[model samples]
Target: MFLDASGSAPMTNRTLEAFQAGLADGWADPTRLHTESRRARQLLDASREAFAEALGSRPEHTHLAHSPHAALERVIAGIFTARRGRDRIVASAVERDATLHAATHVAAGHVSSVPVDPRGHVDLEALARELAVPDVALAAIQHANHEIGTVQRLADVAALTVAAQVPLLVDATASIGHGPSPAHWDALVANPADWGGPAGLGIVALRPQTRWLPAWPEGDDWAPGGVLVPAVLAAAVALQERREQLDATSLRLHRMVGRVRDAAAAWPGVDVVGDPDERLPHVVTFSCLYVDGEALLTRLDREGIAVGSGSACTTSTLEPSRVLAAVGALSHGNVRLGLHPGVTDADIDRLLALMPRVISDLRAEAGAPEVA
Candidate 1:
């Protein structure tokens, strides 16, 4: 079987087991006065504790949301509203779409995008310069990129923001369970799916004493509304399991990704994106000159190999990946691979053996320059 780790992996058995166990307990509003409701509240509280411990934060500080996007949006809006003073929002140019949209939605400020190096890393010096301005209210950067997998110097960025007395919101969706939580940031957001948990839940942990005003009217202390108890419990259990597997899983996936990088280097006209040595262990991206990324993705899928194309977000849109464009990486013929613990050695070998042929076919179809 081919490796399909590019955001296509299903939830692990451990997570499913946890979900089933939770299902047997019963369903009740966690805030209710009944015994079952109190039990539900206990479960939610326990889940919060588990997630908080994994992220190196206090349980009460963590906020559960319906999705990573929701968490990010809530956190950004809360920060922007609460810390309003300046009319500028500073963010890395390569931030995820949800963040970009949130920043754009707030018409009160001008958005300042910090440029990244060609290797897909934020220039800390540039960030420092921007943060130096007293008018910058909030700054956002990812702990690691989702597409190219390049890990950023979050601590350095956080320090600069702290020096500027600005709140730094980090999207750790791609890094959370694979490595240490970026506790240095003012606000942190991550998805459980990235750590082999169910897709519906996202965790946002805010620093204690961080003041946040909700963007919408709310009766509860949850970021926007009350938390999803079952999803939260499932996410916590899944995160714990993913953390337990991190050391070994990272080593194995790193080796596999290294092989992919080496193979891509040998292929003519193929350029790997991101800082190869400084990127996350489970993901890598590359571009094949002159071939269309969508076509390549289709060909791979036909051959039972599933991977991600950086060319488009949704199937309806054909725009190239903004993340790749921000770093000056090739926008065409792009492929992104994200590995998880469920992927096996055989799966990697299958993908490796099939890639060369797929590239050759794609090149022929596109009438591209020879791989020289």
Candidate 2:
């Protein structure tokens, strides 16, 4: 299930076939003048167009990068280049590490952070106040948080940034295909993995008249003429297919997540995170006091339930989730269940039935107080 849609659903046969074809086509350099190169170019263009259509933007405005991280770096560099006087950057306290790090790296002035509510929504008034500063150059906020699943008021934040004349960059990695459209930001970056596309690809969309510069010096080594052909095509096709299934899939998963949240509420010491009504439909996180998240994740893996832990970014340090910490949510034994097409009603029911017992046993083993 983890190999599939973040353990939510399985990939369609069509998507798999497309990926296979792309791989089988082999390593002909896309920039060369051979017939194979032209074919690769065509594939890349089609993919860009598909991705642009999915995001309600023009293909010319989209830049295909090796990863979402790369795309974000480009956007940040662009904002800094375009802005004249301001050297400061503002971001939400709960931003993805990649975004926060990039903002901090490029910022020549103070970097301000807008705090989140206990439920994880951005403080809009605080954001406005930060943006009001004359030296603020850019403001960034995520569409939906990765760990807690809280969706931000993007349109409201975008309007605030616009009023301040500061460019807004939105990281839509968690909510691109499954949530509301991101037509508000000056720039947006979303990963294909969130929408069932293969990894190694991300879509970056720039609003009309938005000027951006690349972080690295102009060289072919970086983007190879700023084009990632095959991966871009695959991502675009995957996004298109995912968009087609989004409405119905979202409704189905909403019901499933609702059941999980309801059952989790009955578990002692379990504190479900995020606003029940205003979060992404497919994700729900809960904290089980006194139990370690890594241990809970391992036990669930043994039970054939592939879920994510909030304790660490696996790729980086083995620390507690920064996202949860920012929102003041429970930090211990937190697990996030991200539903994909592969997860069914029965799967959710099984998890709901087993989770309470699992938490109870773990708490007992840890000698923690019983959940009221």
Candidate 3:
């Protein structure tokens, strides 16, 4: 009954098998020149190629990283260094802390945060104006929001950046596996875990023409100590498998998400967030009045259902969600549903059937009046 399938997913049996095989065959250091090393290198190379195919890019443009957060930090810093003459970075208000922190570090607090509308879509005119500013290095935007699942107008944003002669770095962590390949990005970061692969590995790719300098020391610039061969292989296999089932899985999950939204919206004082039509197929979020987020989360857990609360990245505390605040949505009693492909219709029905009681009971405990 686990429903919080956002940031990570359970690896499939086939992917696990590939990982086990990689452990045996790819244990050697890929940088070495010995027989075992060459075998490991072959596996690593093949994995890179397969992953590139998934991204619609070439192997030469792709590199493996320890994790998605690390990849994001590295990519932003690298591009900022290459465009040293340009000191300012433009990014959306709803970007992950990882992106914002890296941008701040490189730009020395010269980052401009663009606003998003109530639907979580970035303000294109504001973004265009910011990009048009002088000394602008690069702009970072996620292909889709990790929390509310709002898909940005990426092509429009890309056009703005291109016109301003600024490089575009896209955080594709949420959309890579669940949607179509991004057609316009100079640099990109993706999470293998988002596609039911190994969370230990990350995929970072740069367009050949992107003016990105190496952020790390020489020798192992992209990956400081190289990457985990088995993990990379497992990630590649998982992405390929997900791609094969993408069309059908996306449609099924979208319908399920719509059902969840409909059920949740029926509750009084409930505010369902995100664009109803232009959002990711597997994610939906809602905020309930007269309830504490942590209390709601704990109650759901007791009911044998698991879901995310508050910010997708900063769920450690029940602090209000930045994404919700940006969209002018209710921030309390938040529940984010990231529908895993394995979740069946019965699971959704059970969740929907119990939600009303849960909300009402929590409200009673808080002594809050019904909002009608």
Candidate 4:
């Protein structure tokens, strides 16, 4: 059974149907004056409305971007461009590379990173201190850590940013569909594909009172050209479906992840990471001593159980996970299991049954000494 559900997920049947129907109905240019274009316009508007409602924002304030990375960059660029006098970007150490890179670029390398605890929770006092600093353009924090799944103290962070009068840019790309994001952000960006929607659609929302301007040249302001109407329709449909089942899905995945954590922790030289009780329901990460991340993942893949290793976002690079490194964990030999709604109990069982032997054999291959 394939168990790797790290960054993206498969679309549900209902969402697929909506996408198929939209392909036939929403193909025209939404900005044109033709009847077909008008139909496409309606589809785009309806999809934006549905997605905006999910985010607790008005459709007028939301924009469709090509991807979550684009949306995040747009938000950061807009804020920094409008607040020209301020050149500093404040963010937590555990945020996505997209957030850090964009913030750094916009702020001219004046980005200040707040430290996080070993469990991946941000240091609130340090964050407040950083925000209080002058010339701070914006502060960015994720709703949760994509790698370790530690939910941030966003409400408290929001309070601090508000007190400091700095715009808060929240990256909810990892947390939106899995649970309710805090309604305390000044600007927010999310990924549709992360929640089992079609790829290539991103949701970006801004509060009405927020100070932001398009940083791009005088062209298509929000999205460079436009968004795919069928993709947006599928994303909206998928988000609605996920929201309808959020509570039950969260509970079920939480239990299944707990099983994985428990099973992994019982093995020798294994350390389970993240805030166990207050983490994302679907994500669990752990580090194994004397085991190579790639080898362990390869063994699991060979055993018909696919999984993820290294940085959740930059898994292709296979570099030691910066998230794990920040939290002072062993970054080299880690595995991240992202449990989706489609992962069955039998799948979890099969993984649990296979892990001990896999770890033991890998340790033996490494000529590693036994853990005390």
Candidate 5:
């Protein structure tokens, strides 16, 4: 039971085959004037359209980057540079690390963050107030919180952005394949790995009329050379598959996540986090008091069940998660459980049975008094 889909997903067999084929046939430089190059170009061009269509954008507006981190960083910096007059960026506090880092790098001291509620939802009123500032450069927010599974009120926020005439950059990294397209954002970015594609590719779509300035020349739009064609094809295929199974997968995963929420909530010293209803169907997070998150993970791993955690003890330092901190969560002994298509009812049952016992055991081991 490997339940860490939020970190990285296991590639399907088709995805591996697609990647192997890309290595064999797409190795040539697409920009070269040769037969092999021509073939590579064909694959690259084809995948571009497929990727755009998958994200509900026009072919002309999409570009594939080498990695999601590079895509988000460059896009954020490029847009920030182009919109020189706009001096500030407004983002929710709970965005992924890459987005928050880019926001800080691009806007520095001018970066203003909108706080989230205890439920991990962005403060819409505060966002509106921030966006109303004429000097606001852009608004950056995630389509969903990967850690907490909180889905923002996007359409309402988009309307506020429109009224304020601020461009929106949405990090759809976690939500793209898990649910519906986050439409109406001026720009969007997601990782192929998030949806069971290869980790090498990142998808970016900028609306045709969206105000964005490329840091490089127009001729070398995405990069100096072609991207990973095989990864792009695999991403497109994965996206189509995700859409086809979206409703059913959503219903099934939502039920499983509900089971997790119910079990974790009932356990002593564990607090279920995120919006129980308006959240990602595959993700549920909880914090256990008086237990070290890493110890719980190790204990669970020994039982052949792997999960993810977000504790100060597990992260870089003894610092708690900024996400949990932003939402007033305990931040110690926090675990984020993200499910995928690979997960079965048995896996859910295993997790439910293992979670409470390990958490309680870890608490006891740490010499902490147990709660009811």
Candidate 6:
């Protein structure tokens, strides 16, 4: 019944069990020299190694943070400032508010957002132009948009950034469990909650030999003085388990998602958004004209369905989704559905069946004529 996996996925049994085990084995201060602390350090190290192995990164390159925002904000502070003369940060317009806000806050208005096409793909030429600027410090792009599910041409943009010798920080969160990591990205941030892990855990991965510095009260960036050892192990275990089921889950989601896209498109006021073919299999978005986003959400809730409207920070705002606005899509009644492991055909069927009537009813209340 929960379709809003992007907001927070339900923790799996494997992950929950891992959490319990982690609590038992990893609940001591790892910095201490006591026997319990040594055991905790061993558990933490094992989690880091598992995370690195799954991500195709070295254990040394992985850093754990309280959240993805914490990880990316730290990255911008640590790496962006280290470059000295290069102060401008290039980011895609469709990024979730965390990166956009983080870069703007970190760079203090020096963030340049490359516009997205109406389908939500980033403007590659514009990004290349931005990267070519001598003052560009770092470039940030999402592997796939969390709202519209539009998969970016990351390899294409990564090529441009590489040639420009600008570091690329990819928020590969939306696609981490569902697809392969963009092998070319320089630094990556992922929230394990996006897969099946417990909330409040994030991963930041840096390529070896990267020029970076810890900006805050920091010792070793990778080996932070403090960490939630239980959360870390649970996150790594969840990521591994999710990746193992990705192919099967993706195939199932593709069929269900197409049904959703078709359903939304069939409604007169609802327009299916994002790239039709080159998008995430597990997510779909649509904008319903003559309806209120908040009202639609409430109606869906009444029907035993749940979905998300925008970023974690912005979904609660009355303003339209920044991502939809960037793409020139109608945002008044925007709806985004993110499928997870437990979502079923019946769940989707209920949504597809319930949506048209809801949109129709809302439009009728708004004094609009009914769809034929």
TM-score of each: 0.95, 0.93, 0.97, 0.96, 0.96, 0.95
Candidate 2 local lDDT, 1-372, one digit each (tens) = 451244223456777777767665624567779988777777877887887887777888877777778777777877786786788889999998888888888894478989999889999999999988799878889888877778888889988988898888888888887866777888888888677777766678888877666557763133545454545556666678778888898899888888888888777777888889988888888888888787788788898888887765332576778888887878878888888866778787787778878888788888888668
Q: Is candidate 1 or candidate 5 better by TM-score?
A: 5
lDDT of 5 by residue, 173-263 (tens): 8888888888879889988888888787777888877767776665436654657766776777776677789999989999999999998
Give the residue spans of candidate 2 off by over 4 A: 1-10, 25-27, 219-222, 225-228, 312-318
Candidate with top lDDT is 3
Error of 4 at 29 (Å): 1.1
Q: Candidate 6: which stretches are off by over 4 Å?
A: 222-225, 311-316
> What's the distance in Å from true for residue 143, model 5?
0.6
With candidate 2 superimposed using the best TM-score fit, by how many Å does residue 12's alpha carbon deviate from the native?
Answer: 3.1
Q: RMSD to the native, candidate 1? A: 1.8
Please give the lDDT score for candidate 4: 0.86
Where does candidate 5 have its weakest 10-residue lDDT segment?
217-226
Better of 3 and 4 by lDDT: 3
What lDDT does candidate 6 reach at residue 369? 69
Question: What C-alpha lDDT does candidate 6 achieve relative to the native structure?
Answer: 0.83
How are the candidates ranked when ordered by lDDT, highest leading?
3, 4, 5, 6, 1, 2
Q: Write the per-residue lDDT of candidate 4 for residues 42-139, one digit (tens) a residue.
A: 99999899888889888999988889988888899998888978999998898898888888787876989999999999899999889877889999
List where candidate 5 sits over 4 angstroms from the true fold.
Answer: 216-220
The models' CA-based lDDT, in order, is 0.81, 0.78, 0.88, 0.86, 0.84, 0.83
Query: Model 6 reaches what TM-score against the true structure?
Result: 0.95
Select the stronger candidate by lDDT from 2 and 5: 5
Count clashes in each candidate, considering only residues at least 3 apart in sequence or on different chains.
Answer: 0, 10, 0, 0, 0, 0
